[model samples]
Target chain A: MNILVCVKQVPDTNEIKIDPDTNTLIRDGVPSIVNPFDGYALEAAARIKDNAPDTKIVVLSMGPQQAETALCECLAIAADKAYLVTDRAFGGSDTLATSYILSKAIEKVEELENEKFDAVFCGKQAIDGDTAQVGPELAEHLGYPQVTCALEVKSEADGLHVYREAEDGKEVIGVKTPCLITFTKPSFDPRFPTIKRKIAARKAKIAQLTAAELTSIDPAHAGLKGSPTKVKRTYVPPRKEAGVVVKEETVEASAHKLFDLLSKAHVI
Target chain B: MPNYLKVTPEIIAELEKAAPGRVVTGADVNPDYSKDEMPIYGVRMPDVSIDAQSTEEVSAIMKICYEHDIPVTTRGAGTGLVGGCTPICGGVVICTMRMNRILSYDLENFAVTVQPGVLLQQLAEDALKHGCMYPPDPGEKMATLGGNVATNAGGMRAVKYGCTRDYVRAMTVVLPNGEITRFGGTVSKTSSGYSLVNLMIGSEGTLGIITELTLKLIPAPQATVSLMAPFEDLAACISVVPKFFMKHYQPQALEFFEKEILVSSEQYLGKQVFPRKIEGTDIGAYLLITFDGNSMEELDPIVESASEMLLEEGALDVLVADTPPKLKDIWAARSSFLEGIEEQTKLLDECDVVVPVNKIAPYVEFVDEAKKNYDFEVKYFGHAGDGNLHIYECSTDMDREEFKKQVREFLDSIYRKTMEFGGQISGEHGIGLGKVHYLEEAAGSVNMGLMLGIKKVFDPKLILNPGKVCMKL
Candidate 1:
């Protein structure tokens, strides 16, 4: 089986600082990491490879040259190959334009590797934009069945059974081959890379695909000029007030005080 | 033995006048104040306990206690493993927990003045905000800095940055006779007189009560990374430790542990970090190492060379954790070993012994062999780079007194062997009531006599923290 995972490199939000004056992110010294959801997507693909050694895992990303670091991280984990789809023409692309360009790059990558991926995996949403449109839009662009918010996946005789995290509870859904699955966080964290793999990954040759090489891509539907959505404003949300600790000499008294406070506030 | 006066109502009134509403007696006193983390040694409720908040209050209380000839015990967060803070004598217990405060930071001197009651974790985090670091990272983060100083705790990072004694440049102490004095200073070096600061450190509260401290700090490392190397067995894992130093690799922290301890830690944490098996071979032990530098560019080559060296030294594989989440996962398990062991065992006794780095493998092997003759289970781990092992003996089925008796015999053999290896009985944990005999046995009569003489000069009546360290009364 051949699986392709889509990843994005974003500044670590925990370390992200916001400029109080202009309300812009101070990304100068902030470290960049693989989007955590996308890491889960890559781990899902790696889990398949763990069960079936013959499975080939390929990781693809559409970002700047620095994004090769993220791709190499995926390679160190489990990916057999990595490709960065980067070009000046693909800069500042919105979710719609990104999915359109990724659709074309997938075809170019398939032709270059001479293997059609049986499954395509992606993070449910990149933490930076968080629009959550790329995965479903890419599925439509590729004309494949899609599953979102996947918590777990297992390969079966004819298809993959995905445990989807729904609003109510988990729902197990089976989709046939040649499907797309977008994973969210799971109960367990991804594994750390081995030193040997890290050394090899640092030297791995990451293939690149430019807009000129992706001839199938429509120049009209790529990059910032072709994006439909416009982000008018962005600002950090105001922090909520810290809650008051209700304590009394006894537990029952504390409970009573909490109840009275909640009742007065019309929350009970 | 000295006959100490009990805390009468008159004494309580004097203590109340010294510290005001902070004094408590009878059932009002918390039972935890009677013992430290190690209750196996013994516990005794003090007749009166005071939550002292300042050096003045401590001095006044000490003056009253001295006038009345009442034995006094000084305590901090009570996180001591050797019962260093336990109130063994029934007199007055002056706790410094409420004096918690970070007084100031001197950027010029690279020093921070803090109350002795401040916790290790508090100072560790606060220093990072100022782009500085308090490098003595003992395993117990919640322990009070005063307790750490009193015990002279040596932790994982001691291999690179030294221990609590190295960081304590100055301190304000209340003498046993109610006199207030300063020991050492913020100056980097001192050759003027006898180093009272060095003597007060590791005294286990036997000499005087620590009220304030000025600790040394260093610039925080810009980049840090940890490597986990799994080997076939513990001996094989530890044999490569000296080679690291010989090769001139100075890791900030170097630790080694057995697979069973790791398993219990992981189970306690409900997370699996290190792989149990790699390529059809079972991993018997792991060496968790950390390296830091000015930048990743400076550390990359070191990591690469160290990884290669580890594999060459028969490591099954080396795993790298450069990210925050990854490092937390690995270290959280390493730090939770004691909690994991305590959660499963009904009774426990431990010793932290330091030997020559080259003797770690043989010492551990000796312990493994010695434990077989005893009834309890022995679990061990250590700072492999510095040769300080935290060996725990635990059991769930033995009677309390029987367990104590057997562990006493067991530790005697171990400490005798440690002396034969020219090692100290306690590494970071001080010699409280639990290990005083072993300390006397390890440090011969001549050395013990000098320590006792020093104790007498600082505490003539032996009224402060009696039955600890070198003092028996």
Candidate 2:
């Protein structure tokens, strides 16, 4: 089985600092990390490759050249090949134009690798942009059955078995080959990159696709000029009011106070 | 043995007058003020608990305690594992936590002056903001710097950067007799006098109360990379530790943990950073190492050489965690080992013994052999770089006292082996109430007598943290 994973480099939100006066994110000191959901997507592909050693894992990303760091990390964590779709024309592309360009890049990658990917994996949403649209839109562009919020995936003889996270519980869904699946955070974290693989990845040349090389794509359908959606404004939400903090020095005392408050409120 | 005075209403009133609304009496005092982290040891609530807000308040409180001959136990965050902050003899518990303040920094002198109650974690974060690093990374981050100084707390970075004692530049201490005196200075070299500052450190608060301190700081390293080498068995994993020293590679921190503890930590943290199983074998032990240099370009070759050496020494594989999230994830698992053990175990007792680096494999094997005779489960891990092992004896089936009794016998044999390996009874954890007997047993009669003599010179009335370290009374 040949699997393709879509990965992205995102600023680690936990480390992101918010300016109190301006109410804007100070991304200066914030380090970039593999988008956690996308990491789960890659890990899901790696888990499949773990059981079936012959399953080739190819990871692709459409971002700036610095995003090669994320692609290199993907390469270190069991990916057989990594490709980055980088061009000035792809800048400021919304999820729609992004997905369209990704769909084109996926087809180009398939042709270049001489193999059609049996499955496509993506994070349900990028942490930086919680739109959660790219994977479904990409699947629409590719005309494949799609599954979202997948917690696990295993390849079967006839199709791919996916265990998806649901509101109440998990729902197992099966889809045929060449289907697109977006993953949520699973119980397991992505594996650490081995030193040997890290060194190997550092030296390996990453395949790059420029906007000009994508001859099948029209310039009219890329970048911010082609996107219809516009982000007007962004601001930090107002700080919530501080709630009552019961301090009794002991857990039991605190619990008793909380119980009393709950009884008074008739919340119990 | 000295007979000490107890806290009455008059004494409580006097303490309250010195610190104002900060003193609590009897059952009004929070129970946590009576003991440290290790509750299994002896516990005694102080008759009066006073939160001293300033050096003058501390001095005034000490004067009151001294005049009345009341036993005073100085406390920081009380995060100590050895009951160092426990008020074993009920009197006045002078909590310095209220005195917390980072006074100032002397960048030219490479020193930062802080109140004794400033927490280790607070100082670490603050120092980093100033482009400096406090290298003593103790497991208990919330522990007070005063408590750390009292215990001479050494930690993972001790192999490269020396312990808390090395960081001490100056301090204002209130002696047992209520004498407010300053010791040491912010100078790099101090050959001045009797080295009273060194004596106050590692005294476990038996001599005096630390109110303010000037600590030396080093410029922070620009880059750091952590690697884990998982081995099939512990012996193979631990034996490679000495190789780092022999090859002259200075790792910022080198830690070792058994697979079970790693699993527990992973479950506690809800994240698994280390591989439990590598290749076809279940990893028995892991060597968690870190390298810090001016830049990644400088550290790359060192990391490559170290990883190759680790693999050659029979590590199943070497995993790298360098990115911010990756580093945070790996360290969280490593740091939460104690919390994880406490969460799962019904009863727990630990020993922190530092042995010769080369003898770690043999000494740990001795601990393993000794575990067979006991009914309780034994868990061991350590800063392999320094040969300090944290061994825990835990049992859910045994009653607390029964476990204590068995642990007494268990520790007897282990202490003897530790001494045989030329090790100390306590490494980072001080000889608080829990390990007083072991320290006496290990130090022998002559050395013990000398320690008592030193304690007398500093605390003649036995009023400061009585029944700890060299103080039997």
Candidate 3:
């Protein structure tokens, strides 16, 4: 069965800076990193290829020119091939637009490979956005049954069985072939790219596609213009004020102060 | 270059047949599997993720990968420093998060046996419940024991207790060929031939994947006290470190921070740790010292004398604080020094340089001078008592490419100076992707060649975490 893994390049949250005067995200100089959640998704896809030797795992990502780094990283991890959807028109796309564009990319990838994707794997959500709407939305757009919060998956000839986490505990669900899944944390651990693979991935060619190249989508369906949510403002939360330490000489008094603080925070 | 190993559909069918309920394929693969704690990097979602509950499943998966020549990467809690946990190659990712059950805990032997996916914090808390402690605390509470062992992580307590390698008594490793082997035991010492356990300690999952670990433990101290000493001069503060060691006053932890670090830590923690604000004063650095003993009576006198000595040695004042919460706060600040540094700087790249105790002062001086010459800002702080100083370099003004280049040059200068003074490039943080060049420079071609040979011996197929430590394996 052919598998298609969707990945995304995002700004490093740790490196993200906020402008003091404007209270907006400062993107300048921030290192671009693979969305952490996507590692699990990639690992899942790789595992399938490992078990099913004939299974071809193709990676798909969306971003600017720098996003090639993310695709290169995918290749380094052992993905057979990688494609990047980079178009100026696709810039600033939100979950809805991003999912629509990804669906189109997957369709194009299938055409290029001369095969239909049996499954499309994606991270539950990107850390920067944390909207978590893309995976489910993509499934809806593609008319595929989706198993969100999927921790484990067992693929069979007829369909795929998944273990998904829920509010109470876990639920096992079965979906027909060509389904979609959004993985949750602690579901399956991601792997480290070996030294040999790193070299091969570095030399590997990442196929880049533009909006016009992938699909005949209207210009309004991509980029910032296509995104529904607009950022009115972004600001750093105010620094927490230091708490008053009840200068107590004994440990008991200090413990009481801590308990009081915890109570005030409604943690206790 | 050879896709010589053919993965037939029949073999895939066989694997699915063997693991009837374990295999996940297709779009059912989720995106959460893509990345780790660091979300800045883009996501390369996996095609499938297998939640192996037993060693049998892991072995079966590895066997399949070996037969298919498919790349396999083992993951723990995904709390790796470098992108070690990220499947940059997009192969099979065997996740150990579900295999978190504590197999055994022997109180009499002072050892604990646990699955590789057990969280370090959970293990520590469990050990505490048994009236013992695991000393290799690497700040991140969510970090797994396996990840710690993979990196051979050293934390604040490493000054006294050493790193994870020191406590790792044994490990159950899954070889590249899908063979399971146990190296070392619960014994305190080992003279066994070819210490594979030590070899696997910092291999970063490149050799064989660790499934379970037998970790040595120590009796937790009953009484503990913390003291913050503010020094008028940075050199004066660092100069007193050797004296403390020479005097035979063994401290559990001895950490040095610049005034900026201390102030930032205070702001981060939102509490007044020092008696007063030494910021903008002539005082340039502060040393936070901690001592733990079986009893308060035994610790009090040693702490008093140490305080008196610190004052005599140019310390402005040595302030003793209460135990438990206050002590935890001081340590939290010291432990969060890296985060504090990242919060203050634009771009942060750290080098964990280890030199002889005497060379530390010179190394600090050299790095400071390099900053002045290179026109950059660098911060110096770490396990001062252990001679492991983390020199953080950054460009407060330069662009991305120039910043990376300058940081590399600065690192080269400091690394060269460290080598001249007989030092290792990295003290703790293993060579993931960033420090391969420095590892080559420090270890030289001959030693590096031997390491590659060892890598070949362990992972003949080179399917394990490759391109790390010694690059281009």
Candidate 4:
């Protein structure tokens, strides 16, 4: 079986700083990382490959040249092949246009490799934009079924068994081959890359695809011109004040104090 | 033994006058004030405890204690491993936790003056906000900066940046007689009179109480990368430590631990960050190293060459942790080693001994051989770069008293061997009540006499943290 995992490089949110005057993100010294949820998505694919050694995992990303670093990381972890779909025409694309371009790029990738991907994996949402529309939209564009908020995935003789997070708990669903899955955080963290794999990843050839090469993606329906939404402005949210800590000699006393305080405040 | 007056209601009234609403007596005093992290040494509740908020308050409290001839124990967060902050004499415990504050910053001199009660973690984080760093990174982040200075704490970064003593530029201390004085200053270099600041450091609260501190800070590093190298066994892993220094790798931190300890730490953390097997070979030990610099361009070649050298020196594989989360995962496990050991063991005792860098392998081997003669399980890890090893002897099956007796014998053997190897019995932990005998044995009478004399001069009544450090009582 072959899988294609989509990843994105975004500034580490914990280290993010904002320019007070411009009310915009200060990206100068901030470090970029593979979106954490995308790492979980790749780990989900890697675990499947762990069970079936013959499975080939390919990593795909859409961004500027620096996005290749995220792809290389995926390659080092488990990916067998890497592709960066970077083009000036794809700049400023919103969720709708991104899913459309990615759907077209998937076809191009299939033709280039001469193999159909058995499954497409993606993070449920990119942390930076957090639109969460791309994966489901991509599945709709490709006319394939998809599972979102997937906590885990297992490959069996029947098909892919996906345990998806629900409002109450988790619900298991079986999807056929050629399906798409967008993963959330699982119970386990992704494994660290070994030195040999890290060295090899630095030397791995990352195939770059441009707008012209993806023939199915029309120039009119790509980039900023095709996007329906635009962010007018951005600003840092105000930080909340530190909470009060109640400590008594015993747990019962502490609880009583908390209950009394909440009742006095009309919160309980 | 030194005679000391008990804390009477009159003394409590005097303390309340100095630091109103902060004094507690009898059952109202916090039980934690009776001991530090290590209760194995001994514990005794103070007759009175006061949370001092300033140098004046500490001085006033000391004046009352001094005139009444009460033994005063100064405590911080009470996170010390060797009972350094334990109020074992049942007099008065003057705690500095309430004095938590960052006093000032002299950017021109690259110094930040802070209240000793401020936590190490608080200062470390606050320094980063100003593009500066407090370099002393002891494992116990919640420990007070005052306690760190009092113990002259040396941490993982001691390999590169030295210890808390290296960072301390100045401090305000209250003497036993309630005299407030300043030591050192914000100046970078000093050729002034007797180095009183140096003397007060690592005194374990026996000399005076540290109320305020001015510490040196450096510009934060632009980039950092950590490497984990697994070897066939501890000997092979540790054999590569000196080679890194010989090769001028200048690692920010260098640590080595056996797989068994790593397993216990991972189990404690509920996460496995390091691989136990690589290429079908079970890894018996690992060396965790870190390098920091202005840019990756400068560190890349160093990392590459170091990786090559480690592999050549019997390392099975070297793994890189360049990202923040990866670094946190590895370091969190490394820092929790003591807590992990403590969680599973009913009785525990450890020694933080510093030997010559070259003597680490042989000393560890000697320890391994010696532990076989005892029933308790032995586990160890250390800053391989500086030759400071934290060796712990623990047991779950033995009776408390039996474990204590046997461990005492075991430690006696260990410290004797340490002295023979020309090593110090206490590295960063300091000679608190727990290791006084070993310290006396290690330092001998002549050196011990000088230390005791200095204590007598600084604290003539021997009323400050009585029965601690060089004190025989």
- Scored by DockQ, the top model is 2
lDDT of 3 by residue, A36-66 (tens): 6776787777777777889888999988888
lDDT, model 2, position A52: 94
- In candidate 2 the C-alpha lDDT for residue B350 amounts to 91
Interface RMSD of each: 1.2, 1.2, 21.0, 1.5
> Alpha-carbon error at A115 in model 1, in Å?
1.7
- Candidate 1 regions off by >4 Å? A22-24, A167-169, A232-268
Model 3 achieves a DockQ score of 0.01
- Candidate 1: residue A92 Cα off by (Å): 3.2
- Candidate 3, B294-391: lDDT as tens digits: 88678767877797789788887665543243465567777666666666667556788889877777778888788886656787787888888888
What is the descending DockQ order?
Answer: 2, 1, 4, 3
State which candidate, 1 or 3, has the greater DockQ: 1
User: Tens digits of per-residue lDDT for model 1 on B37-156?
Assistant: 789999999888999989999999999988888999999989888887788888999989998999999988999999999999999999998999999999999999999999999898
Q: Tens digit of lDDT per residue, candidate 2, span A1-268? A: 9999999999998777888787778889688889999999999999998999999999999999999999998898889899999999999999999999999999999999999999899999999888999999999999999999999998888799999999999999999988999999998889999999999998989999998778888778889998888988778767588898886779999999999998998999
Candidate 3 regions off by >4 Å?
A1-268, B1-48, B275-282, B343-346, B373-376, B395-398
Worst 10 residues of 4 chain B by lDDT: B5-14
Tens digits of lDDT, candidate 4, A1-80: 99999899999888888787998888887889999899999999988988899999998999999999899888878899
Instruction: List each candidate's DockQ score.
Output: 0.64, 0.70, 0.01, 0.56
Q: Is candidate 3 or candidate 4 better by DockQ?
A: 4
**Residue-level lDDT tens digits of model 2 in B151-253:** 9999889989989999999999998888899999999997887999999999989989999999999999989999989999999999999999888789999
Task: For candidate 2, give the docking quality class from DockQ.
Answer: medium
